[model samples]
Target: MSNHARELAGIIMNRFDAFYRRFLDITLGAKVRFESKDWLGVQLAGRQRIRLYDHHVNETLQAVRDHMGGAPLGQEGLKALKQAFNDRLTEHANPEIAESFYNSVYRRSLRHHNIRAENLYVHGFIRRATDPDLTPYCWQYRTNTGALGDCLRQVLERLQLAVPFSDLTRDLGYVDRYLQDHGPAELRGGEIGLTFVNTLFYRNKGAYLIGRLEQGGLQWPFILPILHDDQGGLNLDTLILSKDDASILFGFARAYFMVWCPVPALLVHFLRSLLPNKADYELYTAIGCQKHGKTEFHRDFLNHLHQSRDQFELAPGIKGMVMSVFTLPSFDVVFKVIKDRFTPPKEVNHETVKAKYRLVKQHDRVGRMADTLEFTNFELPLHRISPMLLAELQQVAPSLLSIKGDTLVIRHLYSERRMTPLNIYLEHATDEAVQDAIDEYANAIKQLAAANIFPGDMLFKNFGVTRHGRVIFYDYDEIAYMTECHFRDIPKARYPEDELSAEPWYSVGPSDIFPEEFATFLLSSPRIREAFKQQHNDLFTAGYWRQLQQNIEAGCFVDVFPYRRRQRFRFLYQQGNDKPGDGASPP
Candidate 1:
């Protein structure tokens, strides 16, 4: 490879490497140790790694499916799996779909062989093909017969041409040679586990990021923290798999591609122009300021608002999580800055950033989120911020945002509502307050779900009571749509091993959601819990979620009125015909 190519390759690799550690921490609950470039140590201390028999890719698939409680190619599972794949294909073709696709792929690979779908696999042959003779070697994994090759054919049918098994094999050999001379074998303690591959030839389509974690199975089942991006801001939008049934394959096919291809030729001209000037920051600017091409009036107002609030001070909100609310002495609009780093980037947690943006943008439409100012960054030079406000923010939301060096900047969310957190109000309870709280909470949940949104964490702190006494969800980090979540009944642990194990016996897919836990999680005290049970106990069952999901899927809109049931018109809501209560109230 030429010097230009090598440099471009390094730049490409660096972009992917940025999120590698964070991905491991969030997805696999593991850590990474960079011993050297070649040998990376993925510490598996904080996770569950089950062992598998040698060369049992199919069995591992069954085990993984069982762990996630997914039926193995059962009618429903097959439908869901196919939908998942087709979802990606559609997203690639067009971006108008409302449902944000998070493609998470898992690989249960073998030697030179790579398996993508249950029936889709990739294989490599050692000898290069010339002219028209692209025959596979006998050593090739199950070629021209059975499920493996048939699977590869399925994938090949989708691509332009069948990639020769030898092209990959020849390039992989180049990587091995490079590593033999300049490798981290010694520093890795020969423990990076590269001695054998189930297959010798495996190639993957789509973008490759770094290995995020190490799940220590008897043998590795794909690489943990393996992230795939199919053009969604380099987010972990898709999970790609490389499964093979072969032996003596090295660490990664991507590594070899980088070593051999180097510049990729095409990107060099583009990358070179940026080299003379520090154009990388232009890319960083693109990421950080994605919502704005250049600063508009409103955006500039938000990005530079701190400068104007000189003598006027604001007090931080008390007793809450997920947001740092500051009270304006003017006492109207409170500043709600998403404490910097309050949520992981979408690359790790799929739609967190998108969810937040949705909540703010749709606040009025959903009749929820306190009318918000544009989501922007708060920039307060270290010298400008008041000591009292800083100390208060630190006390209430220590992790909300932070000050680095001489500057403090964080994602800001300014809202016009001067509402108290419902949890705080509940601390000094009243019958009226309790009734309103219960009614508003239920109303918000139903309305949001009706709008296809689910606040994944339904904690009291996440909800607020507007001065007019309506409860609305303010926190959006864990928010997701009702359609995306797969509500399920918890699977009972059958085996003693499963019961005793800390990790779940059943498989936990990324979208698997258990509505059964909501009752205990949302309703706090016994009184509040019983109150919720009296009104909305159905929330604790899978049936309710399933029906609601079905209803939404069937093009039904279940509108939830914002007013309390007690306050509704007598005709709109009556408690067992008990004189239907008060005034000309309407829901």
Candidate 2:
């Protein structure tokens, strides 16, 4: 051989060795494992085994060598060769081939751990395709198949496309037609009778279908079930309910959506804006009951009105009077309609009691009558009163009364035949008298606090004086915890070192309030100013006000009460000036 041929032969041998080493590394522990000893002694094996095995190995090695020629192995060249192998493996491991092999060997794997040919092909493909030197499987697949090729076709066949809104309507029509032709009688009836409502997707609330039922030319509102979505869309899986049962399922679905939905607080204002005058009144009444039923009349009247609407008519009675007394669980409100036949009383004296009785009796024959001469005490539960009712009472008479726990007892201002004296005085009292009354009220509150019983609401209206001038407290939205009272001087600007800012201001824990503020708030009244100075003046000062402010900010409003100051009323006869039996008046 010439010098060139010898160099070529050496290069070829080098190429063959490099290819064999690379192939061994890629295939090792997979199809073949090359022990160093076996690789060296391959030719020394017996004839039959040696001839068959060596021939196969030599043929594969020769093919690799020829593919490389005498070319010096470069990074690009090695990469190309690796990629080619991966591509071939991937083709053999395609799903069509894998599926066929899987079906064939699935039953055979019962006893032996028989591996399917598809799995073996896939394993080999993954091993080869994942090698760093190889081109990516996706790139190879794309280049080989083109954009509109087999892989794309398979994906399209597997995925169900979303239908457009227009298409959906068309399909729904087709469904109706199909039902008409072949569906069950019940299904056809449902389609015709039930209306298909529009679907909505609320951001926080979820999906809902709002439909109206048409029966006898009347439409009723209905809602569908709530729907949730991970990758949110109007996809089939996101359909909360099927069209067939959309009507029946809408109610629950609507409720769920409304409950879970993120509604803006301002929506309440928007809704109010749309309500008519009467509707607005009704809504106001409803919300007042739910939010502010602390006042007796508001709570009692609302309850009574609801009940009366169910039982009575609006016309006047034969006796020329209509009387209605309504009672809620905690309070009562009475409405009287008097006919022109009876003379109205100018003053609420004992002589006019018969007229008052007859007036109320005309409206509601079963209503209870008020005993102006006696002191009535009744305990009621708190939950029965609505907050709106309290608000209304506050507006009507802000300083005439208060509520404590469930009882709403009012003191009579003077003897009244038609109206209670307390009601007449409250309705007619001058603003100055009201203010003076409020001042005396403050002093009474201070005394009540000293008795270890706090009148929860300190509003001037919640306290009233009876015919005998005894102060009484009513309105009990918050009561109890009187025994836990502690008097402290609250600072105005500075907070006490012991007070923690962590607690809520409305319901601050007992230990958190500064006693000084309680003293300052008590001494704030002019009626109590001189008395407080003479008796408890040292307790009320600038330091006290500061501490009280801090406690108030910290939610110590309850601690400001004079818990020990509850007053006991003296009977009229006990005072030696009244004409009554054993200090008790006729009821």
How do all models score by TM-score? 0.40, 0.20
The root-mean-square deviation over C-alpha atoms between each candidate and the true structure, in angstroms, is: 26.7, 39.2
Worst 10 residues of 2 by lDDT: 252-261
lDDT of 1 by residue, 1-587 (tens): 23332332233233222322232232222111211111111212211111111112344344445544663334444335434433333433111110111111122212212223332211111112233211221111222112322433333233222222223233233323333443332222222321111111111111122111111322221211111122221111111122120100111100111111111121212222223221221221111111111122233334445446552234433533445566545334456654433433323232455456544443223455443434333445666567877775666556435576886655445544456677777778786668667766776777677657777778777677754566767666677778899989989879878868877778889898887777656765876876676567777788877888887787663323222223222222224644432111222
Best model per TM-score: 1
**After aligning candidate 2 to the native by TM-score, how far in Å is the CA of 468 from where it should be?**
3.1
Clashes (N, CA, C under 3 Å) per candidate: 35, 66
Candidate 1, poorest ten consecutive residues by summed lDDT: 245-254
Q: Pick the candidate with the highest lDDT.
A: 1
